[model samples]
Target: MDFERSLDLLWRDKGETPQPTRGRKPKLTLDKVIATAVALADAEGQATGSMSQIAKELGVGTMTLYTYVPGKAELLDLMVDSVLAERDLPGPGDPLPDGWREQVRLYADRTLTVFRRHPWIQGMSMVRPVLGPGLMAGQEYLIATVSDIGLAPRKAAAAANGIEVYVQANAALTAETAQVEQQTGQSTDAWWGQRSVFWEKYFDVDRHPAMTRMWESGGYDVDTCEAVDEAFVFGLERMLDGIEALVS
Candidate 1:
């Protein structure tokens, strides 16, 4: 996607792009176009989605959409930001949690909530970031939260990013697990247990000492499907612990 093109579309409401009127009746709005595209993506997978498909769903010619959104890439940027705006991150003057750890947790939890609601987001690469108002608000929240603590400016920003990376990675894993279940028509637990024969027949304790030790110690007792969430929390707290040590 063109960098300037995305930024223009993303900040269009802020006057970055022209909002000229096409018809006296105004048949469609940018929000309507983006909303319809989001619904289509939510129903079908994002990879399978296209501008023609969205246009078809909206009952308009595909070319008509270009007037409002530049293309699929820009539309995707809007769609992601639209969903992200659903989060309830408070404004600067609003009452917020007192503890820094709680503030960080709030950001992580809200982001994961968005990911679960829109599993298709797991397919989008946020490395470039949407850079829309929705993402900017989140970035502000994290930066402000960590900056209030005693860490240096860069380290605080780094801490926020570190937490974000862990959250996104786990969110993607959760989405992948759900996608596998949907595609195979088999529950994750059932599919995992189906591979028990591999552990029993091909298992070699000598070759995999760590696994053998963990298994013998009942570390593998939990249902992995159910444990994915627990694993996320465990890892998140460990990361938080390191950050807290920095603060101290």
Candidate 2:
């Protein structure tokens, strides 16, 4: 992919690009094309969302879309960056707070928020890095926040990447679980309830003492299940503790 061209399409002044001389003025802008593609992908999985589908959504010919966006890959790139732009980070000139740990926590929460809002993004293959303006700014902010805590450049990047990966993976699991619940019309607790009869009948108490003890303690009860939000906080704090050890 031509990174420069993609960046131009994402961030540069649209008027600066030379207009076509012979053809009628294009009805669709790049933003419109990308927005339409994003909506299609959000509603349907990326595999089912195609150039033809986006064209139909925009009421334009498939070939005409090429005039605005080069192809699906580039369009995907733009879509990812466009969503990244929606992240409610601090404005350009604002200084990051000095509380590094809390800042990292907030960053992870924000990332998880993005993932939950656009669950389809968790499924996208990041084999090709799309360093559009929005993504670049996010990266800079994260690294700078870590660096402000006195970590070296390499460690800062690693720390930021680790937090991001943890948040994304957890958020993806949460989203998938929600999707399953929606499709099956059964909550996790309801599914466990359905299986409780069989479990009571055949559960091996002698062979699995630990499992037996946990069940007796009501650990498997629906009300005892760890909330997703609590799990996230617990895991995040533990991760930060490890990083804090290195910092100390």
Candidate 3:
């Protein structure tokens, strides 16, 4: 598909049209279907889980699941929303005690934690905005926190979206890393180590100066959350600095 069509599937803002329920009446409620799907994802990874697998786990036929969720896509949306519900939020007017940067740090950490626990959630979430309450509340909290830094509602919403994108992108990369490890029975380090010789043989130092510098800087260390956090801090400061300059 084209970029816009792919983005449409990712953001899914066209409105919440429930898939027409079909097939034999399921003994399962929507909640059961969602919950089972979530459980299956938790255990097997999102890509590994399928409608048939989920139905078998719930002791229902695949057709029975179709009655509740329009298809695997809808089921994924429900699973994401359900996972979001597990996240805790700061209370109203609790005062994001440490200021905007700290508030954002905590927010990103919490989001990352959730994605780590539910790795499949990263895959499911990027598919659409289901207007699910949990996702809405999380966004609302981010906007409110940004407003404390004196951003107007529109600006705050935009900033919150940017932060959300960062968190999701990081989690997606990490999840892919895990999947690679699972499939190859090798750590990312080992895989890269095996490829380093090939890269060294073909990659010219003069032709890709910047990439050579980055590669020489010891690339892709998994035990570098601190480095990642520092980059996140740097990016956030840049964002806020740009906003401050604009507002000033």
Candidate 4:
């Protein structure tokens, strides 16, 4: 992953770039390269967001691009961090939203916005964090919000992590649903409707008591992939309620 190079570039300031050893007078910055990579990934898919493709998009040679950044691995770290900055939430010095729950909602809302904007990000693995400023900043903001609710520091971090876990999974679900529609050329409703026979002809109430009960009890009112957003909202609120309970 070009670990050292990626780590160094991750912490580099926006204006700071790699010093190009004597050559044709450096023509690009690491930020610009990463920005182009992000744009490419946003417009096309991540597969097309490679180093060669980035240089093609930027109208520069791949070697020239390499001079600004080490390799695709390093550039990806920068791109993920860059896209994450889109949240644009209030950070350390700025005032957080009214209540702790409200602040958490704000975090959820901003995160969903970015995920929807860059659905490609949903497919990527963040198994290891980039630990860049953009990521650390959001982490700091959420930790502060959770701490404000009077939880211990470690617990506050856990709450923030747990909240983000749900948020990210919800985002992946929604994004993948969209991806499926695009790939299969069938909208979720149409795809889901094609399987209605399973419920009508194959589903047996006696075989699945909980499913039958929930369906009869109107618990499936917001069911199905069509109302995924509403379901996510309900789940998020319930999660917040649980967190609120801890302090109460």
Itemize residue pairs with steric clashes in candidate 1.
none
Query: Per-residue CA lDDT of candidate 1, range 1-248, in tens?
Result: 66686677678778545562343344688888888888877666453578898888889887777777667877888898998887779769888887878887788788888777777888888897888888888888888888877899889889988887898899888776666666567888898689989998998989999999998999878888668878998999999899889888
Clashing pairs in 3: none
| Residue-level lDDT tens digits of model 3 in 115-163 | 7677766555465566566687688878777775667778877878888
**Model 3 bad stretches (over 4 Å):** 1-32, 61-71, 91-97, 125-127, 210-230, 241-248
User: What would the per-residue lDDT of candidate 2 be over residues 122-241, giving only the tens digit for each residue?
Assistant: 666554557777677677767767776667778978998887678767877765665556547787778877888877798778989998898789766534136676788889899889
Sorted on lDDT, best first, the list reads 1, 4, 2, 3
Off by over 4 Å in 1: 1-5, 15-25
Q: For model 2, name the residue pairs that clash.
A: none
Off by over 4 Å in 2: 1-4, 13-23, 45-47, 95-98, 178-198, 201-203, 206-208, 218-226
Please count the clashing residue pairs in each candidate, in the order shown. 0, 0, 0, 0
Using lDDT as the measure, the top candidate is: 1
Best by TM-score: 1
Question: Candidate 4, TM-score vs. the true structure?
Answer: 0.88
RMSDs, each prediction? 2.3, 3.3, 6.2, 2.3
- Backbone clash pairs for candidate 4 read none
Q: Global lDDT for candidate 2?
A: 0.73
